[model samples]
Target: MKLGDVAKLLGGRLEGDKNFEIEGVSSVENPKPKTLVFCSSKRDVERVKDIKQVALVVHTPVQDANCVVVEDVKYAMAMFLRIFYPEEHPSGVSEKAYIGEEVIIGEGVYIAPFTYIGNKVVIGNHVKIYPFSYIGDQCLIGDETVIFSGVHIYPRCVIGKRVRIHSGAVIGADGFGYYIGKEGITKLHHIGSVVIEDDVEIGANTTIDRALIDRTIIGRGTKIDNLVMIGHNCKIGENNIFVSQVGLAGSVKTGKNVVLAGQVGVADHVSIGDNVQVVAKSGVANDLEANGTYGANLPSIEWSRWKRIYLYLLKLPELFKKGS
Candidate 1:
């Protein structure tokens, strides 16, 4: 597409050679000749003119270069390229797919080969189950949900519409619950279900545990990052963002719009309020109030002071070697 055509396609204003043809989209730092490069923010405006690409996408016009200015440069660039190089939407089920008995597969469902749909499972319309996916017994998958390759949904899991279950995600895993009995140490029973609400995107290899007698619920639009572990009976809130490797203990409750950054750990039975933002690697041992930010595992301090303090502490063992 030409630079002028790309700008029209992306709903952006072009301030360059309208006849310049753009083959693809790329980054400004490493621009491909025919490809259109994009700027990150206003700070990238300085380098926009020096970019080697034919077309550049930025928020405002840059001097001495062919550029397309848009409200959201990155989003506009993405939309522009996706239109030209569009990914194939998931379509029909293949003949080689292993569909189980009593499986109610809905219309427009894409069932890849070797996928195991268990008994009494109701798959919704436009759902895509990639190869090697395992949907366990009696599961209900909502419409437009995509279960990626190697995903394992255990029995009775209720997945909602437009939910994206990434590769290797294990839903409805057994809870880490145990109890002491008269005979010996016995394992507690897990008899609950996992209900994932609409527009939630579960990351790869993440495990969400089932409850003891109720439900482990994930609210709408909650985006969980890769390698996170959500323990049993946790009630996650709507539009929450849980970053990579976050660990939420059992019975934890979060209100709407909560944000947990990378590697944050929440203790069991803690109730976090709405709009809370936990920083990266935070160890949240207590409850967080609404709209509050707390729990930093890594303390921010002056590097020079920390180095001096560490150096003094390191000489303690040597100073007291053979004496007091």
Candidate 2:
């Protein structure tokens, strides 16, 4: 695609050579000729000034390079990649796949080899269940969803449309619930299910547990990264982003657009409000209010307070010695 055509498609203002033929998209740090890069900030614009590769810049226009000024560079990049580098899904059901009794598979679905579809399961149109995937009994997989290899969906779970569950992901597994009895500890059985709403993307090795009662719900457009653990009865709101290694204990509730960064741990029954941003390695023990950037230990403080608290902690030992 030509630079001018790309800019027109992205609704961006074209600068420099409009006729430059673009081959692929890449990052500015690794500038490749004929590839389109995205400059997300003014600093990125300055960094890509001397870069010869084509760029998609936000707000700022590069003087020397062939650039397209877009309102949102990241969104444009995602659109461009979707158009240019569309994923190739496997076609047709494999003969080696095992379909159990009363299974209802829709048209255009692909069931790969070694996949097991349990009894009374309903797989929607164009859904792809890859090799070694296990769809348990009474599960409902929505249209256009892709379940990658080694994925296990436990019985009665519901996966919504346009959802992408990557390899080794386990949905609706029994949560870590136990009861104290006179005899000893008794294992609490999970009687509920998991409901993953539309446009959600669950990464590899991520486990979403089944609730003790009702459902463990993942709201629409939520993106959960690899190795994340969402415990039983958690209610995750729409468009939330949980980074890798983030762990949510049982019954944790998050409002819309919440972001929990890498390694952030939320204790059981904690409530995270809408538009909240928890920084990396945060330990959230108490409830968080909306529209603030929080970080550090339990009862996550605002970013500014966290910085001050962190600085004061370094001088604590010296202050204690002087007082003694």
Candidate 3:
């Protein structure tokens, strides 16, 4: 692709070398010849200023370099990646795949070898189920959804259109529910399913548990990162972002556009309001109001300093008693 064509496709302003040939896309850290690199910061521009062979997609033009200046560099880079590396999956069902009785498969579907589609399942158009994936009985997978290798969808779960569930994701697994009876601990059987709405991307190895009696819902456009654990009956709202290793206890509810950072833990029955942003490693124990940023975890410091602070905290009770 030419530099001018890329700028036109990205709706960016071309600064120099309209005829420069961009054969690939690369990062600013490792510039490659004839590749287009995106520089969103001044430091990134400075790092690649001396490199003459690569074209740049930047917020501002660099002197004497072929540049395509865009308002949002990351979005432009995403578009470039989509164009350059379009995903290609096998189209037809493999002979080795196991299709059970009464399965309704749509046109243009791809089922790889060793994949198992259980009885009475409805798969939508252009859906791709990779090798070793298990679609349980009566599950409904919507159009253009891609279930990667080793993904296991439990029975009767409803997945919506354009959803991308990465490798090793386990949907509709039994929630951790138990009761302490007079005899001993008795396990409560989960009877409900999971509903993942449209355009949601579930990362690798993430698990969403099945509800005890009702649906555990993941709303539209939510992006959950890897190793996330969403407990049963979690009503996650639309466009929410849950970062890697976030753990939500059962029956927690989050409003739309909420952002839970990496390793944040939400207790059971807590309700977070719309547009709330919780920082990394925070523990959310109570309800959070809408449109606020919250954090409770302390930042890392020197070990000696942390010990001094810990000592002060330990002595606070004695100091308070003496003051009283």
Candidate 4:
């Protein structure tokens, strides 16, 4: 593709030589010859100027190099990659797979080997389910969904369009609800379901618990990373990016585009507003408003500070001795 063609495809303004041909896409730091590079920041512009490349996908015009300016650099990158490597959809139940009675499978569905799909389930078009996947009864999966190996989805769960549930992700496991009893603790039954909205991608080993009385709702375009624990009755909103090992306690409500970094822990019943960025390892103990960014505290204190605090605290012994 040529530099002008890339600009036209991404709906951007090209302020460069249209004659240059790009063989492929590459990073700005180490540019491959005749490859498209991206410069989304002014700092990146200086970083990529001298490197040999065909053109740059940028928010501003490159000082002396070929430039294509777009409204959003990241969106343009996604679009360009989509165009560059177009996906070919696959279909049909595998010879090694097994299907239960009254099952409703849609067009262009690929059910792989050793998989079990239960009755009265509506699986939508272009759905690719890999090996050992188990979909329980009355589940509704929307179009273009992809279920990877060893995924166990419980009954009555609603998985929406373009949703990708990766390997070993257990959807709708029974929630941890117990009460004090005469003999011991008794388990409360979980009767509610999980509703995963459109364009949500769940990473491997993630477990979303079923609710005790109501539903657990994951909103649109939320990408949850591996090992995330989403408890019952939690409502997560649109386009949120949850990194690995983030744990949301029960009944937590979050607004749109909230970013939860790695190992972030949310307390129960708390409400977080839109565009709030929770940094890595931060413990969210209260509510957060929209567009808020918090920097977490460092655990390791300076040695002198620690010693001084320790010595100040040890004056209790001196006070006791003086009193005696």
Clashes of each: 0, 0, 0, 0
lDDT of 1 by residue, 1-324 (tens): 788887788888989799988777666566668878778676665654555456778887877778888898768866876777775667888887877789898899899988888899999999999999999999999999999999999999999999999999999988999987888888888989999999999999999999989999999999999999999999999999999999999999999999999989999999999999998888888888898988767577999999998899999898899577
Cα lDDT of candidate 2 equals: 0.92
Q: After superposition, how far is residue 28 of candidate 2 from its true place, in Å?
A: 1.7
Q: Candidate 1 or 4, higher TM-score?
A: 4
Q: Residue by residue across 1-324, what tens digits does model 4's lDDT show?
A: 788888888999988688789899878677778888877888776776454465888887766688889999989999988988887656789888878788888888999889999989899988999999999999999999999999999999999999999999999998878899897999889999999999999999999998888899999999999999999999999999999999999999999999999999999999999999998999998999899996485577999999998887899889889999
After superposition, the stretches of candidate 3 with alpha carbons farther than 4 Å from their true spots are: none
If both were scored by TM-score, which would come out higher, candidate 1 or candidate 2? 2
Error of 1 at 293 (Å): 2.4
TM-score of 3: 0.97
Which sections of candidate 4 miss by over 4 Å? 299-324
- Pitting candidate 3 against candidate 4, the one with the higher lDDT is 3
* Model 4 residue 300 distance off true place after TM-score fit, in angstroms: 5.0
lDDT of 3 by residue, 198-253 (tens): 99999999999999999999999999999999999999999999999999999999
Q: TM-score: which is higher, 2 or 3?
A: 3
TM-score of each: 0.87, 0.89, 0.97, 0.88
Candidate 4: worst-modelled 10 consecutive residues by lDDT: 45-54
Task: Give the clashing pairs for model 1.
Answer: none
